[model samples]
Target: MKNILLFIALTLSVHTPLKGFELQHIVEPSASMISLQTQNLCHSLYEQKGHLVCLPWSNPIVDTGKISLLAIAKTNEKGLGIYQRARDKDLNQSFLEEVFRNENFQDISGFAEARALYKNTVFSIIPLHFAAGFKLNNPSLPEVHFIEQRQTQIKLSTTWFLDNPLTEEWMSYFIAPSIYHFDRASSSGDYDVLDSATTPYKDLVQNRSLKGANADLALGWSSKILWLPSVTVHGYRLFKESSDCSTCLPTYISLDSLNAPKADASVSWTIDHSFGSSVFGAVIQGKRLFKSIDQDQSAFAYIYKISRLQSYASLSQNQRSFGFLFDANLYQLGIQYSNEIQATALQPKRINQSYAYTALVL
Candidate 1:
């Protein structure tokens, strides 16, 4: 009896720990990759109107007074994984340190945009605007084996405004068609025969190469309410086939079918003062107005701008972030801190993230 009890105790100890590691491998790399990719792609941009708008739908003509050329880079504390240094001063030793780092997961992304507005337009009394940009997202787990993920997006868009774009009360509309491609490879390492032969553990390896194209549109209107504070409303939508939308934005992940078009709306109140500008707003969208698959469908923001400086802070069901930007005519610098929930093997964990960016404005 004593020998049998000892054998059982040893078996439990070995198998339990191994099982935990196996479970972690199952949801790792890919799960972390998806979380980072979605956040990077959906990050919003700051607008003069004091509203937070997604990068793809931003109206460059209004955001920047004239022809604009901008380059921006973002990264976390782990190091630069997306935008590498132009020239490495310590190439040999630094390269070795990067490979052996015990980074469980990391996200790196960046983008560049160029835009111009043409006056005396044939389309409308306002101006015809054109913008083009590209984005790249890379997330990885350095210590994990056989793990790789990358995504690239290209955007080309045009815009038309009405009722004098510069006026206090105005409206604008824009359309953008974008294309993106993503590649991912991940595995759970060599599985033990006991686990591999199990019913649900047979398929623990995945290699996917996918591409998608989507057409997006947005309509925005702002007016003085009772000649007091100004109010702005915006509606945005995306059109795509169901299969192609397997990896759509977080807002659309909960849709039963992508064939049914869905749109999101946001409303904000702006107060213009001698000091600067202030805005408060909330976004609403989808069948699940409160929560979505990975995050809350609704979001809120408060922004204040004075002179060439702006401060932004936001809140949602599961995330909070704060950031500030300084505009020095031809140059801009910004940094943001984010706190959000991230999925893990056993449970959910809260992640504290930081982002720093710089841009040159032409």
Candidate 2:
């Protein structure tokens, strides 16, 4: 993992996209490239607004403000012409989904090379699995305070980016509304009702599993500008139902940050907000400093995150959650990594981790 991260850091670092053009436009400039960026951002904003105010909207507020990134050679004719192959410093998750006509371009577009598609895009993603949660009830709820298992019960799920994007510019909305399906496992392997000393739970844990289906919808700015309003909505329930678990609250989260991503290609920022029954906390994450042996072949970026939560929710308190992503590529082969922190209503509080397999196009 460390090696791959190092490689990506190196690959993206020295190959400054903006450094190529002439020194006329502010030390370095590409007039045509700039036009393309301005046009696209304008078109994107118009399209995004249409999604919200039109017939049937899906998610959030507004999308990106237009910004000129490059100077492109205009072709006059149009059928998905290459207006420009621009680069964005802080493309957020949602915008990436919006702009990429063909999602999964990040995984399929040959490692971020400037690709000109006649309105064509290629995309894919490494599947991922996650399981984690923490309990927040008063410690006194349990007669025995000892954790049957120190680890929280892990739930798992996997997804392929059907229409994935490499850069956030492809994404739509201040918070684009996108959907994906997931399966959640029981939050704990341990039991709350029946124990070894107890009759029912002891018998159940022997061959027990907690599993359910979930549908997730994301609402956040495609760009990573901080202090922006963002949100998410998820609907999930066990395949089977019981009296105690029937009315369980659904999951929701909101994040708002003001930090911009690093322009040096060596920094990242993360902000989070989680809502659940037992866990309640907010973490402000930071970027890890980027370092690369080869500034050309590897892309290094620093990342930082902050998380602070009560871990126990109630009428007054709420839950806080977190997620992390890391990846790198060497030549063509590549690997990806991801992590998420969930807090739920349980004892001892739990945390779940996740992993992904990455493939970079040659």
List per-prediction Cα lDDT, in the order shown: 0.39, 0.21
Residue 189 Cα positional deviation in candidate 1, in Å, after optimal superposition: 8.9
Candidate 2 regions exceeding 4 Å error are 1-175, 185-215, 218-327, 330-362
Model 1 CA deviation exceeding 4 Å by range: 1-56, 62-74, 78-108, 112-149, 162-205, 224-237, 241-263, 285-297, 343-347
> Candidate 2 on 217-245: residue-level lDDT in tens?
22223323333222211111212232234
Q: Model 2 Cα displacement at 54 (Å)?
A: 27
lDDT string, candidate 1, 1-362, tens digits: 47954753453334211112111111111111111222222223334355433332333334334554443333455444422532454445455444333333343333444445343111111111111111111223222222233334344445444456566444333333322222221222223334445635435333333455444454454434423322222222244333533542332011121123344455556666768766666554332221222234346767677888877777765557777778787776777777753222311344456655555545
For all predicted structures, in order, the TM-scores are 0.52, 0.24
lDDT of 1 at 319: 58
Q: Determine the backbone clash count of candidate 2.
A: 87
